[model samples]
Target chain A: MKDRPLILVTNDDGITAPGLRALIEVMNELGDVFVVAPDSPQSGTGHAITSNATIYCTAITIDEGDQIEYSSSGTPVDCVKLAVNEILNRKPDICVSGINHGSNSSINVIYSGTMSAAVEAGIEGIPAIGFSLLDYDWEANFEATKKYVKKITQKVLDHGLPEGVVLNVNFPKLKEKDIKGIRICRQAKAYWEEDFDKRTNPNGKQYYWLSGKFVNKDKGQDTDEWALANGYVSLVPVMFDLTAHHAIQKLNSLGFNEK
Target chain B: MKDRPLILVTNDDGITAPGLRALIEVMNELGDVFVVAPDSPQSGTGHAITSNATIYCTAITIDEGDQIEYSSSGTPVDCVKLAVNEILNRKPDICVSGINHGSNSSINVIYSGTMSAAVEAGIEGIPAIGFSLLDYDWEANFEATKKYVKKITQKVLDHGLPEGVVLNVNFPKLKEKDIKGIRICRQAKAYWEEDFDKRTNPNGKQYYWLSGKFVNKDKGQDTDEWALANGYVSLVPVMFDLTAHHAIQKLNSLGFNEK
Candidate 1:
């Protein structure tokens, strides 16, 4: 028999999250699975690493499986770091984060702990993908995601991703048949319109709750937002290189170097 | 004074950091300045926002100046959100974040709260820039940065940045005369080789201190890494669009849509 691909599974929703459990089951069918995930929920952590503090990890078995699991008191990105540098004896063939309980589409990826974990794995030169369901409920059905996730993971292992790139796969909240297949799309231009709910505490100290409406102004059919809104699973090939290469010429034209 | 252009200033090192005070002093020369910064340091928070809890902001006077400052109990990105949505009476002509206490030259931008603040402002459709010095000390002399900061900020105010773009400027640790001007460069390919210091805590539990050595493998002379190493201030125009556009066609060819 051909050797199974060694797959590292992780999530930002903590180890016991149903989304992560669903991912683990899917990954188990495809490879030798090992999980190193955050011990607590770490949503919206972005690409934060544990720099200013110490991290602690402990082994746990959430299910009877061939997979070994370790839960860490760190952010999702830190989990990737610990897994690669401390836990894994050898580099895994692939890493998959999330099956996140909420959308990580469009501009949401910038604030996503799920995507950040995948980005960390990508930074370490591993083929990685972050999977998120559009549904936010903890009990959201993930059966529709398995087939698509497997196909994408298999394709990644088959073809390999471009340098500095990782797959950000987000599924619509729909039945398997209702999911109108996958769309390779660009990140949509969208932003959160923050509304701070200012309130006075019992001690008379004021505070504000961060709440927002996601505003998607781009009407481009080729955008992830368009795909997700139209019931298609969106797969945006995200890159870690944040440089605006086109702006270099414009900045150079400003005579910054002449000084 | 023809209504000195309104400028918003902020930093990840908190309101009291000398670096921010230096930036505020610089902005005061060219504009009517408003400051909204974290009450405590939020250095490596990345693009994190205060979604899980309430944020608090209080007005404070750090120095005698025409500029007004508010200290927020939130991440740098939260400061930007609150500033744009609640604090600023009008949309500032430009937003500037940080005279960050350390280099945000290459991959450091991914982990920087300073750059994240600027990026948050850029996302809100304001022209923005993040400035950093190579020195990590709180008392690092920032006199060398004032001229360049003014020049760059003026240039940005003169010619607005392209949509979705922001400036990430980093200075080498050197005297004003030792600085070799500025270079518009691309973000260098670099990463941290993490050295986790695993230790047994007093309670007999294992813990780790996150520390790392930055490794720059890219030899491109046009990279930010090269410019900084060569004593030149590096200016990398950063974009919030994380899409790997080049990979879209490759992904499409995989029959993702046909399935």
Candidate 2:
């Protein structure tokens, strides 16, 4: 393959995050890499873009690498948009985001900035993937995830993904040897049980911190949760289409127009 | 019915948008409304939350209505988080967002702050709906939409939505008489064809504005786009599960194994 694949790399963990550095290292081995990510940590900052304010992007050197890097004053989605629209001269063969510090399995995808970058690329007619690990530690080991990441990325490059679909890959935090291979799975039926910590501010006003414990109610062994818990890296092919097709038929039968 | 349903209302178009006002008026007839919305427009801001900066919120009197309003310095998702956690004493019976100025049909749901608010509430186990009009004008007619909004809201009050599912309701911008009826449909397979408008700043650097035309390639008549085009109010039951359950079997065949 004399024509090296062009890979656009980004992350929700900002440019300097250890997770991003790990991701960059992995992508460097695979293709002609280009890095465009937020200037600051943007965890939990889903698909946000800078609309009301002007965004500024600057080129910076991350290390002695052939890849071009830019730091942006925008969200993860913005970084993708900027890269595709302003930076990249041509559409990259594939767009890969994260190797994120935490998991974006199940419903967490809705609030994940890492996945949003990939989703944005998918929306733009590019094959994209978002990778995350179960551990939230800054020094979480990503060395173990490289082979699987490369395999999946190569597969995606070889066989283009279906339109509007992207892959969400989450790895369980374990030593490389302890990891049970990769399993393609569905997102688990799970939700956050919100426990708001309310406290009085020093000014005698009340404030609250949003906190929650994840509760996975679905017992399907074929789900991302099961895959991760069993030490398998989970790969869920996700689509941006949120429609419940089966429920539509049920709703149509409700005589919504009977009035 | 003196104990009116506790309805938490919000929007991506800011607390002062006409669309939010219309939603507030409709909810006022059904419940004791509590509005916690962003002080500024938060369009295109998916599920972002404020973590790096201290958020400021204050009770504000926008009009002479019994509905209580609070403006916050955060994203639409943050509004939901703040409202449910700090402002309201109890979980709302229903959380309604938008009456958005533009359509959140199809893949737009992924980038929509309007739908993100509803999805956020749904994640927290609240029955939620995000409403939008096909028109993108600030002064789009909400008169005809009110009837459908009320009808849908009433039905939701009567029949609770399924767990992990929310509704994305989009109304075709038509005259009251031109409107056909409401239809429950699946999300259309559509995407934005992004064409970045590149321009140079005074500093001689190039930047781009993200702009695009929406393209609906799906021929399915059972989609939200089709329903809206046929002069009907489209309601798509959306789920937070991003997993493609059907793909699991194919992945199982890949022969992944433990090291």
Candidate 3:
């Protein structure tokens, strides 16, 4: 690693979000931080990129900080792409996304814009991490998360992540003193049971709001859901290669390859 | 399976797209088809949901077919969710997305709206497949794709997909007579070498268009890239579990679990 590493910062909660501001503060203590994030909130925009629209990234100053920042007219993934390919003259030593207001544990990772940024960075061969808290309120306290966030980032910087892998770090809604140490975990077999909020407008037009209750069926203690429930900050090693390697042989036996 | 199976059809290219119409035509032959697709083109919208926007799905008739259709003001993933939860009264026998006007063979799966719908269906515990052709033209002939599409769908109907797995099938741009049979394959280690088209607007401001060249370095014949290049249909079984199972032990040994 360089004497002073270049750190790329981003979040789905937009550039002016309090969560991102808190992230920038801690990242400043670690390295030369440069934030390239979305101009507007982009929650649930998983792995999306701006191909149809013209991308515009402009330099912005939200607060007094040592870190430089740019707001882009795109999704969280687009910010990461812009950071890696256009904004940063050289490759960053590490990329960190979100001190997110909501949890991205278990099945929520598939719908998370925060983790999508981290995944995009990993796809570009950079060590990356996505951090989130259990609380979903805009006024949620971030004081406790900073301590462990710094610790986890330092640990990753000290020991580089594995090839094609990134970390999805999620915290329980607890005080710093109440929080347990970092715990390595797996993504639990969990899902959202959708119950859309169906409503009719004044014009008699029907619309729906996507709402769901998270259902965790896995009873394994070695999962992110369990760790967070037990007051420990869960760290799941995430990979982008979506191939179900175990099923390949079974598929071969199904006779598609033959004739 | 039911004698007349209830099939859920969807695509990222919108309800008016010829690719989707082609998909509906094939699905109608196999079962009772229901299409819930985007109202506009949503090519690069990978796994995105419409949580931030008011989702509107209105019943519409696109063409003459023994199928029902709904045009949704949402992304591809949202279409699948709506189909599974609200639009369809019962569980679908299988969810099929696309006859997409472009390739979703390798790394493009991460950015593909077509594959995202299939992945969403798989997440919802439905057997699903995404079909795409190598050609990018809007009016690309899907005539060559229908025969193999029917055969593969019938095969999948006969033998269901493994739990938590979905198929990503891509066809080479070829005539029906010139096309080869299906080849079960793995996702290739391929990526886009991004080169942004930096430009200046009439207002003297700078903007960028995200453009990139597809780069494939993997020489393995068992991969999707190799199969497509060799005039065969590539079918890669994809999973949504982002866990890097192999790296869990490595991360443990690196001592994140240690106090």
Candidate 4:
């Protein structure tokens, strides 16, 4: 018999997070799962990798699952890199990240450690997906989203993803019956309005804590924000290419070489 | 007279990097400049922001210039946030990051701390640009690229950039005479072939050091990779929108809700 598909699992909420455990439970039904994730929470880390410091990875047993788990002292992206390069015996058929406690929608994808792991895997030519829930609470209910997760994962394995793309799947925080359905949508044009809390340090020096309010400026009904707001799971096929193809012509008209 | 454009300058290279200095010099001629960058090098930080730890920021006078400079204990994105939310008296007219020590071309844009700062600025409704040199050296010459930098910065000031978009400008590492001018291009379909050096730690732990070779798969002459190869500066207008607009239709066909 052919071996079950090798599925690599990871998340930014750390290996011990409840969200990671939920993801593991879902993936176990699909394939031979190998998990490599950060030992501590790495939310908002984006695509950071450890360059200035040495990365430490260790094999660990997280639960009673058949899947093997490894914990690492690195960012979410680093975890994927280490897993694909050092831990995994062969290239995995798929890489799945998160089922995160918080949303990785719209601009959050750019700041998400969960999605970064998936994006990194996609860069390595592995089909990957990042899943998140709309609830930010640590005790958010994920049981309701498990069916959709399994369905999506199975479908991806049945028909592979396109090159240079990964899925950013965000589920609305509601009862399964309340979820209207899934909508494949564009990342909404949204941003965080930063508000740094300024204070004095013990040494009489000034310091600041980073804080922000999410602002969605785009009024488009076809955006991820709209889908999530209307009780639908949002799936955005995300690409790492940052080039703005539309603006290139305008830049050429600037006469960059004119003396 | 209208107030000088408040231009915020920053880089992934530490505050003392030659590239940052060159950027400051260029912005000095254009507007009121504020330098808020990392105290140490923050290369490849992507869009990371400090959350688990306290951020320490202090004002420091680097040289005899009218521009204000401050060093921060944060990543490139944090520097931009701190500058806009705390340090700067007003929202800067533009935010320019990195005349970087190395290129942030093609897929490197995703892992770039330089571009993250620019992306952060763009998210905040400030026109942004990230500048880089093809040569990855501490003392790479940037003198010849000054004129082009001025021209582009001026055009951006005059025309303004589209919302949620920023420029990723990469200069070819050649003398002005040999340079073929500039090309507006898309991010080349390129990636790093990860080569991790696995070793055992003194504590009997397995560790990995990240290393890679850049592999450009796209041969299109209209790509940033080709532009850099042909001795032309590449201007790729980058957007934070990670959504694959074309995939929406394909995903819609999946019937995700059909149980």
Best by DockQ: 1
Please give the C-alpha DockQ score of model 3. 0.77
- What is residue A96's positional error in candidate 1, in angstroms? 0.7
Q: Candidate 2 lDDT, tens digit per residue, B36-85?
A: 99999889998887755556678998988889999987789888988887
Task: Summarize candidate 3's per-residue lDDT along B77-158 as a digit string, tens digits.
Answer: 9999988988788999899999898999988898899999999999999999999999889999999999888888888888
- In order, the Cα lDDT scores of the candidates are 0.92, 0.86, 0.91, 0.89
Docking quality (DockQ) for each candidate: 0.82, 0.57, 0.77, 0.76
Over A88-178, each residue of candidate 2 has an lDDT whose tens digit, in order, gives: 8899999999989999998788789999999999888889999998989888878888888888888788777766689999999888889
In candidate 4, stretches whose alpha carbon ends up further than 4 angstroms from where it belongs are: none
Candidate 3 lDDT for residue A44:
93
Candidate 1 global CA lDDT score:
0.92
Clashes of 4: 1
Instruction: Give per-residue CA lDDT, model 3, range A1-259, as digits (tens).
Output: 3698899999999998889999999999999999999999999999899998899999999999999999999899989999899878999989999989899999889889999999999988899999999999988899999988888888889999999899999999999899888889999999998999999999999999999889999999999999999999999999988888899999889886444
RMSD of 2: 2.3
RMSD of 1: 1.3
The DockQ-based order of candidates, best leading, equals 1, 3, 4, 2
lDDT of 2: 0.86
